[model samples]
Target: MNKEGLYRDLSTVKQQIGLAKQFLESLNSVKFDRKNVLSWFKKLCGYLTDIILTILEIRSILENHVLNKKTMLLYLYQINTTLSLYINTFVAECEIGEALNEVRIFTTKKLSSCLDGIEDVLIKGISTYPENVGNFILWMDTALEKMSEIDHLKEKEKCLKAFSDAKILFEEVLSHAMSIAQVSMSEDYKIIRGSSQSVLEGLESLSNEISKENPNSAMVKLFAETCSNKLCALERKVNVAVLKICLSTFAKYTDDLENIHKFCFNTENKSKPRDLDNLVMEFDLHVDRIMQIGLFAISCSTNMATCIKIRSCLASLEALESELVPAFNAVLLDYCKQNCNLASILKNHWLNEAVLLKRLICEIIDPLAFCQIVHEENKYLVHTLSLDVKANKSKIDRSVTEQVIRNSIVLDDFLKLITYEEDNIIHIKENISFLQKIIREVKAASDVFLPQEQPELNFKVYKRCKILLNGIYSLCKNFLVENSENSFSKEESLGNEQPVVTGNGFLDHIINRGKQILQDRSILYRSNKIEAFDLRSTTLSKMNALKEKNKSIPLSKLVHLRKISFVQSPTRNQISCELQITDIVNELRNMSLTFEKC
Candidate 1:
């Protein structure tokens, strides 16, 4: 054969050896018949060795007479070394693969059988052996790790699917066991026991079997402990149920206390002493009944958990009797002492004190009685009471009429401050401050009045303040716009002057004044007090126009508007105008002089 034919043969042999080595390394389970695989690998190694020997013989023949014998011999030696190394590595990998395959097979078989056994117990409604179940979970986790290590994708996928199915089955068995235990100990267990007794017996037998077979397994012990705890909880629940019979009686006593409380404190109720005495007697009877039931429940309680609950219920009843009832009586006595002539006061409507009493009745006394009857215990109850009194319909109406009149007077005074004769920036700022204060007061008042049944009072004030504030803000914006235009015109007029190249001359003085005006307006524009001014329609329109002209720059830098912080600085428009004025001044100073003999 020619050299090319020999090279092709060597290449084919190398490819075959690579394929055989890959097959040996990829084995993941003994189920693949490791004996036959080993036999095939041995044959492949023998064939590769034979091919290497043939190539060495050919190289020797070529080297015997060739001028390039040294290179040829070197190539043959490299081929021999490579084939030898590949064979050694392939053998070692095959051994490791075989061991891993054995482990995989063993783990998969054990986990499968464990899952099947668990499923059978679950079907029988028997208690699961926690030791076996826990061991199965640990084994499944290890199997997954081993499967991930396996080189053969198909074999790994197969084993992973089987193990995953087994894991799912095991989980289902655990869930079934918990459900059975829960049902056996539930409140309906008495009726269900006749049909489920055999199931519970089977579960007990399964638990015993697990204890005997896997007593050393930590997972199994934990499972058994959990089941025992659940059973104990069920017993406690049953005992507590026996003590819960008095809850309805206790609830009735709370209702009786509530009625007596209303009778004593509620102004609308006909609170005669005879009626109060009768209610007290009725409440005492309910209290005695509650005590009777509480004693019986306490005696019947068989566990600490049940006793604690029963004792808490009885204590609440005792508190109502000793503390709550007497407190209501004391409140009634106080009311009687203070308002002994309440009926006479209500009858005499012409007395000046009677009007104050009427206001107190409608505002404070009625709402307080309502809150007490409804058992409202809000911490803000006092604040709510003050708000409710202030927002009374009569008071709200009177306040609204007075506020409208007062706001009109204030607005008239503010309007008089506005004039087109000169820049009213300072007065406009003051008006803005006053308007903001008024708006803030209106907002605060609205917070209290808006949620009331009648919100017209607050709504009217808010609307009035909003309109006045917007009007003042518009006037301020117009004044600033006209002022800025006037400054721009003055700069234009000064730009036509004769050149003064070096010194600060007449044109320079005018430029400095224009710059100062720009600076002053910029200060006013970015003022924190002006943020409220920005809320006006005209100011927002002007800002939006300026924003469009300087879209490439940030609005904050261009407009000198503070987004989050409030500090005065030059706005973008002011900076741009200042730059223009400086440019005009520089141009006028650089103009060529036209001088005559004068």
Candidate 2:
């Protein structure tokens, strides 16, 4: 028979066997016939064997070009063997139910094996020829539908597991193919256009499959959507790659301009106007390329993704132009200005302009402009600088104020010990020594403020130093006064306690007047009250008063006080007094003399 006639006769017999099996299953036990059932089963097995033999003949005639011919032959052979086994066992034992059960189990196992075979073929086919993924995916759908017709749950589950594995394999193969296409397109678009077109065709086929109402409809739709999204992303990457090419070309032009900048400033050229003009003209030659790249980028900015890339490229261009043009112009202008200055410096050495210009460009303008550009790049720098400066200033102010206050307290303690009582005298000497040490420390701390270059800070430190010095002078003056007064009081008390040489009234009266004069001196010293004085307030008042009196004393002069001296000598009576009183008067007289010398 011809191929078409044989195929039609085989299909008719297979359909008749399926109808007979269904009719047998619909029968009750009361109506069952072992002879009729066995006849139908034999006929079904014979039809399957004929179909397999016919397919093998067609394979030989057609050179095995049909899809899965070997797998179809293997499944048909196994099913036919199971049917023949059931018929042999039934004829020998006359057990219809047992024979039918054995055949059913065998058939289910063969169907499951068939499903595995189809999955294996799909995996191998798609991987070996990814370009034909469309055909393998269709085969998988048909195989799964056929497996679902089995009555056994275990067999059906096995078929479904194989299908799921096949689906994963297909997705992996398609993704790999897409990656290869993407890479090929990046290298040469024209060469890969055919491959990309084939991928598009495959996707179209998958889309058509998704539109159908089938068992795996959701899975197909999910895969199609994933591929579509990937394609869209790949298209964006293409646009970005084009924009990058334009950016690279524009960068080349900027680099050329930078090179020209270097050539013009090369020291061997001697800053000649002719050489600089030639270099600048060469730099201008790239202007056409820059404009072309800019135009291309602008033209490509039609879509949102490409527009973003184009905007980024444009920003880079703007930065380059802004930086390069200004730098070029500034260098030229500064060279001209400095060259004129160099001419005035050495009228005969015009060639030295090259060295001077190079120094100006390298050492001064370039570094300064770079710093300014960096500072302006981020607006946060100015705000952060202001905050840092304010914080540092406040911290320094607090430290300085606290130091001044501590020094003032020390000076106050030193001044309070001016009274020459024995305890006060000892403390007075210790405080003087302590004050000297503190003055050295304060001076060292104030030296830090001097280098600050702030006039207000220097003046503040100066005022604090002046206050400390005046306190020292005031303490010395009060100590001297109190010493002199104590001396005079001791002399008077000694005179009063002397024996009354009552024979001469005038001598007695003179002694009494002398005592009165000493008392008045003590009263005058007490009224001065310099020990309890506020030296800073006193000095400030004196300054204000001096200003009011039109006598502006210099700080140097104000820090020094006039020393008090005594002209009076101890009389014979004072000398004849107790030795301790005489020694006290003598010490005071020496101290006063020392002050006079100073």
Candidate 3:
């Protein structure tokens, strides 16, 4: 098969695996009888078998394309992580965690072994040993069989699996992950970075020369055209997915620079400084947008050197823009048009402002911290909600539902307020208190139906709520302590008490299962010989250690309003391309289905 065909097969396998996960997740919604349990197992097995077949077919072709093979291996690692998580979720929902303890261990070991092969391929540019793949497939098939037996045993005991039906989510994680590899491989950023640095330096030189009482017209024109050419070069290299998002902006930036040069030297009259200021600001906005896109692209990337270079280039561009603003204004203004002294004063002001701007950029969330903290928190919230719904069979009354919905809107509003009005200490504190109150009310209402006697926090909804509220309180206090004049006591400053990770049969089972998988994965990645023998104590200790560590280090970074707000809406061509790709994958999957029937 060609690359396109291979990609289609991979896409189909991804879809099949997703469907299998969905089927497992729906165990709670559907009556978990023997038939239902057996159906889920069969469906999962079929998906796995199909995926294995596809892998075997692609193995030969994958070997031919070294770079693609690396991407595929990483993709496979992601799939392993996804499968591990889903398997743990299945164990939790089925309340057969004990039965899957050995399964978890063995499966994790096999997957980690597969990871070692993948890493070898990545580091050494060697294909994985065939036995590594064979061994993983063999063990995974056996693991499925073992899980099936456990499911059947649980069904025999009349225990219901607690998984609920969820919307079929498109796993676009691969595309995001691939962007890093693709961008690095393309090295488009190198050209853009180089060009941008040249533009910035050229602009600074132009500004310095223009600041002279007898500015050299030839030199000014030379610097201006050089900047424009560099921008044009940057624009030409915008074919990569990440850079494509900034194409229009980059083009406009080039156009604006050219226009500024034309007005300054080509035209009979120079525009007013205010007019030039507006033009410069418009140009600055485009630069800002480009920087924003670059920040977004690198925020979740693993390539540290690339990120550092890209960011450094952006920062220089920004500082140059700051310097250019005043210089451009001084150069344009008739009163100070030839006043070198006035230009000197403006330059000093610009220097001070540029220093402040860079400092402000630092206050913006560290990109790595943003990914680790914000993304993980979001993922945890999603898992918590899913687990809560699965565990709670009791239906909420319409009144309660309406109330909760309203409270959610209020919470959203308050969160938005906190985000926007970050400087408003009083406003943030008030909203936080309201947020805590609303959460308590919601928990109280939820507890009316969900079993409360299980002190183990078996009702995950309550635990989620507690965590949510505590997180808000902590966030508010952190904001306050950072911005406030008055000092707070240690207890008050820490905000609400953190929810203790207590020992409970259900909770322990879930944590231990997931923990073991993570521990195994960590052992492979990290040099530390960490183990999670006692679930409760280990979990609590780790939580405390993280909390303490985070006290000195920021857990969350403040993201700019503009950064989050910028959405790359797909163009018609992009939409059409996506549809065509989808059609191709569907056709491929249909062919596979026909083959399966035969």
Candidate 4:
């Protein structure tokens, strides 16, 4: 196109766009008075906008061929893409707004003539109808794709995060709507068709994008079959499946338990439990959907079977059962007693059962306190073995690992609160005696595990685990020091009852000492000798002697003695990571050969 022709074409398109925007603005204000007029006006506006935008893009691409054919083509495509998004957004907002308007008018206008149907009709026409939902998903998926291709990494990241959040929010809205519908207005078959179309369209777009980043198209295809396109329509069935997943397995139960505990205990909001119930339902639905897809895969029968087999390896103990039952029952009964109000009859019994399930969850999770649950649940071990079966099943996603830890710690803290006797006034610290012992054992185990090559987390996780454990210890120690002459007599366990580990001044000493060790400024020498079973209080004679000696020690001496108990009793070698083994050996040799003292 020549310059004169191009100018004429651009001006014509601009005029058409201006007219179209005006018509759209009119539709935005559509009322009963102008609804009929604007309805046809909106259709004309859409047609003219599409034609003009397309023509403008074609002209731009033709004019810029020599210098900017590719660049201009991409730019024009983007412009068209954005205009297309605005059209969809405008239509959706306008339609929904109009439906809302009709519902309000009918309800308040006291129109007793078939008015109840209007509210339901509006819902069906604007939101829950399969066609509307399918259209919404299509528009959202395309807009997200265009947004994903933005040049800036930060912008790309923000868009991806927003897109993910929107997917979650949209899914929630879809599920909630499906849940409330008494009878499906549309056939189950139609709903499935709509949901499947939406899923497949979005899935293909996401899959292609994920494939570009992942570079394992064939593996993705294998998993692709497991992401059923009909999931949104199967909400009820999926939720049941999700509940089963949450309640039926070790990993799933512990994960849910932690989440629920946090929901109950760790919220700044008073409505956290309410939010948690919604989350729990959502999670259960997810579990159901995942199971439905994974368990029913036609070709990958073995993978689902393998997941089940892996789950069966949860360690069962006959003896721990005695101790676990009561603690579990106590928490359960308390929760059940709290939630006795009934919503539905079927749910009343089930909610009561959940009231009782408090015990099973508590018992199953209590072993985590003793560090035995790691060996019990052992998802890592299961994944390692799964490698042989599938030869392709990757380890759990990093997000899963993070969620698990965050949840587990929250539960552990909850248990700690329950176990702590905060109001015993004089003897409120029955548990404080065990804190140092636990810390010592954790430190020793960490050291032993540090040099191991088998588990393959040597880079940092051990240190991280050690830090978390130390934080817990510091927390306990501060509790003791803060309440030295006082008690938890005036306090509740919830609502910021105690300070975090770093809140105490004494732990500052330990942290600074660690930093010094890291910088090789000092070696931690053994401060106490390991006796030959004499000081261990093996016999009545030694016990009597120890009691006699304990009564006379100064307060400073007692604190030093207790702290030294964790300094690796009887080990002669200095404990420091940066200390060279060779240097120590050479020093020993030099000491042996040391001659005439000058």
Give the winner by TM-score.
Answer: 3
Residue 55 CA displacement from its true place in model 4, Å:
1.6
Candidate 4 residue lDDT tens string, 1-598: 6877755665555455455545444443545333453354346435444533445344443332321222222222222322322233233335444322322221122211112222222222211111111122222232233223222223435535533433443343233223222112223323422343344355446445543543343433333332322232233222222222332232343454345444443335343445655655644433333222222211111122122221111111111112222322223344432121111111222223333333323322222222222222223333443343243322323333343344334334434443332454334243333434443443454354434533443323333434444444334333344434322221111111111122423323323422332222100111113222231122224224434755331121111001121223334222221132223233333322331110
Better of 2 and 4 by TM-score: 4
lDDT, candidate 3, at 94: 53
The residue pairs in collision within model 3 are: 28-163
Which is superior by lDDT, 1 or 3?
3
The model with the greatest lDDT is 3
Give the residue spans of candidate 2 off by over 4 A.
Answer: 1-40, 49-62, 84-598
Q: Candidate 4 clashing pairs?
A: 242-284, 242-288, 328-359
Cα deviation at 148, candidate 1, in Å, is: 73
Error of 3 at 86 (Å): 57
Score every model by TM-score.
Answer: 0.16, 0.16, 0.20, 0.19
The TM-score between candidate 3 and the true structure equals 0.20
Error of 1 at 567 (Å): 78
TM-score of 4: 0.19
Ranking by lDDT: 3, 2, 1, 4
Cα lDDT listed for each candidate:
0.33, 0.34, 0.38, 0.31
